[model samples]
Target chain A: MSPPESAPSIQDKLILLVEDNPDDETLTLRALSKNGIRHRIEVVRDGVEALDFLFARGAHATRVGWGMPTVTLLDLKLPRVNGLEVLRQIRADARTRNLPVVVLTSSREDEDLIQSYGLGANSYIRKPVDFVQFMDAVRQVGNYWLILNEEPPGHVP
Target chain B: MSASLIVPLALSASLVVAGLSWWNVVLHRRLRAGRDREEARCSAGPSPEEEQWRRAALEAAGQADQLRLQLRETQRELASLSYSISHDMRAPLRGIDGFSQALAEDYGDCLDATAHDYLRRVRAGATQLNLLIEDLLSLSRIVRAPYRPEEVDLSALVAAAAGELSAAEPMRQLHWDVQSGVAALGDRALLDVALRHLLVNAWKFTAGRIAARISFRVLETPGPEWPPGVPVYEVRDNGVGFDMQYAGKLFGAFQKMHVPEDFPGGRGIGLATVQRIVARHGGSVRADATPQEGAAFTFSLTSAPAGGEPPGAEVALPAGRMPVPGPGMTVPRHPTNAR
Candidate 1:
């Protein structure tokens, strides 16, 4: 666990990206930047880090300046923990249950897609192989979560 | 008077002998008639027990066919599962692609000639991965696409394919030989995809020729497994054909007989798609090609029975029932409670 005092600053309307791979994290950020999304973005490299950030524990214990992010772009496959397990925990907790979780994974499997929806995923998008298309999909997520969609009471500080 | 008495005794002896011979003939005839009646009763077709056995054997064969169909369904489900697994493989590939592109774009001048070459190789690998991912996705989609049977004018289908090809290269001169009113019973969209793949193959392989001819017509002969008069459509082209030895690999995904330089298009997914669509409609495909001469692709089609769900139809989840907190949330199955 990271030191509790050095909590990363939390801000409203932040997009929390839960991705284990650094390459995907960078690509996702690049895609968001290309789409003109400038809202504060947080990157957690694994499922455990994501849980720590959302629940305000471990290194993020003092992250009380802002509420939870407007949306979480989660990848299903992760190291330390799986994305599905993270989502299950999020839905189980009272504070982050209503948070919008957009599962942006590279999985095109019907089981994963349907099960994500069944488990209360706000939107499910399979990452496109083409960077240009991936950029467009990321743009839509930004638009929907940051601009169009209304914030849940828990997410708004 | 004594001589007359002797003549009368001789006549009486001759009449008794004749009567005995006639009775022997009548008894023999009655015995023969009774034997013929018994033989006819024994040889009157099969017995009732044998008839029952024959019926049971036929019923068993029918059940076996049904079981085969169920097996096919299970295979399709397995394919869906595998496709889901492949989805996870794309993540690292994208990371490799994305970071390499970023490195090239953001820090190009910092690297020398050797580094640039390495970066270029990395980009090339990423591009290849992208192409593979696209093919994989489309192939999965072809396996799962909806199918609805209707009368498809194959002439129109070929024409549409040719129209697109010609549209792509308007200046090129090509001749088309399409049979009129050639129709089949299948999903029209799927037939269109199959025809496009075949036609595109023809157009691609014939790129070296000055003037090439492509034909679309129905084969008079049926496939080996199909009954007589079952329609088999052929797409023949005068192109740089492949050897007969490699024909077996034609319908396999990612199977290539020619280099990208020689064929110049596609990643070997066209024929696989054609095969899948044709099979879903209860048909088969066969190819005959001669190296540096020509090739002919024949595909047959038969509509599926009514009320049969298409592949991947079972995977559709009811969207409305996923209960969120605000609205449209109905069924509340706790996903995490494994106990």
Candidate 2:
């Protein structure tokens, strides 16, 4: 008896992956490629870059009016700002309040899970070490969030 | 005239004595009332026998405090060791698994049949090592981490695990029945792991069977599986059962029973983790099975905290970490060949 979800209006498929570890970054890229996600995948090494990219500040101020990525895969442990703080900043901002943030990390601690969901994360995905399973997880993420899930409001101009 | 003077003096003396005695009575009554009020405010006035027990309890408590400190130190050490193993060992495994796959993909035609088989085996070994490291870390973590006690919907947890098992292998014809409203007071995340392990074991042992009937039912009646009035849970499966004589070895670390040859993908640490979780809750689990007649695991949750206190209306209380054999455990050099 509920209303149907709003369909996505943006044609560009941009995925912003915030990860610091080089090995994991490589593995994630491989998994994303294996899943055939040929979207404009922009990888940021730490939380600082992630915030800058999202908010159009610091180094990324050149693209001030650019639209936000469809899905932001946020990693918890980063060099400068860390993932939880980035998530808090994202939730605090009015422009990116409804942005779909999926926490992708290796930590299975209950503390991290509670904190991620507490910060209004849309989903939390624990990265499995096995290559095959990791690939499958990436595929599911792409299929659901990128392909099926509705975009947040205030995107179309 | 001298007699009259003596009489007045005697009356004065009597008056003085009477006033002093009256004040003494009032003071005595006040003292008795104060003592009685203090007694009423306390939980209970210990009897002579209870007082003696309290002295002995104090001595025992002093000894227990020392043991608790020792246990905490050991837990800290295990946490560090687990970190080293996870970071130090797993990094190489990723390299091996990743590069080998790249090798196989990039240059498959240049390699001979033997070379191809050798690379395949290398990748498989690295994958197996990854699984083993994962199992070791989980085992260490279950013991090292603090407990969280709360009301857990056990039936729903088992159903979820069953759904995952079936989803993992969508082709299998698996029938799992979980009784409704089966609940317990314990850590939710921990109890889920224990339940998942039991279910996974049943699912794994029954791999080749055409008909796999797994049931998770609670014993409503007061039976011997639990105390006179307590209920216990039973996980029954018509899977490949082992001899009862080997049951003693089932809950050991890196157990040789579940080699890659006999079973496809198991490190034999799942049951051990279940045992650790049960022990943390001050509960006990037992297994019985006949070869090919099926196996059943029955567990009763006493759910005592690390302090061994009876569970009251406590919610999500973090228990002190109890020490278990961690870095001291010996993992086989080649787990697949160890069996």
How much does each candidate deviate at the interface, measured as C-alpha RMSD after superposition?
Answer: 1.9, 2.9
Error of 2 at B154 (Å): 12
First chain TM-score for all predictions: 0.89, 0.90
* Tens-digit lDDT string for candidate 1 (A1-157): 4334444444336889998877788889899998899887889988999998998788777676556888899999888988888999999988889999999888767778888988889999988765667888998889988999998876522
Task: Note the residue pairs that clash in candidate 2.
Answer: none
- Give the DockQ-based CAPRI class for model 1: acceptable
Task: For model 1, report the TM-score of its A chain.
Answer: 0.89
Alpha-carbon error at A25 in model 2, in Å? 2.3
Error of 2 at B149 (Å): 8.1
Q: What does candidate 1's lDDT look like per residue over B1-339, in tens digits?
A: 111322222222222222222222232223234334434555566556545544443443344344334434544553544455465557777777677767877898898889989977886787786676566556555545555666779899899889889899988788989898997766788888889999999998888677788999988765565545556789999998899988887887777888887666678878877877676565668898988888999876542212332221221223442111223322211100101
CA lDDT of every candidate: 0.68, 0.69
What is the model-wide C-alpha lDDT for candidate 2?
A: 0.69
TM values, all candidates:
0.67, 0.58
Model 2 achieves a DockQ score of: 0.15
Clash total of candidate 2: 0
- The numbered model that scores best in TM-score is 1
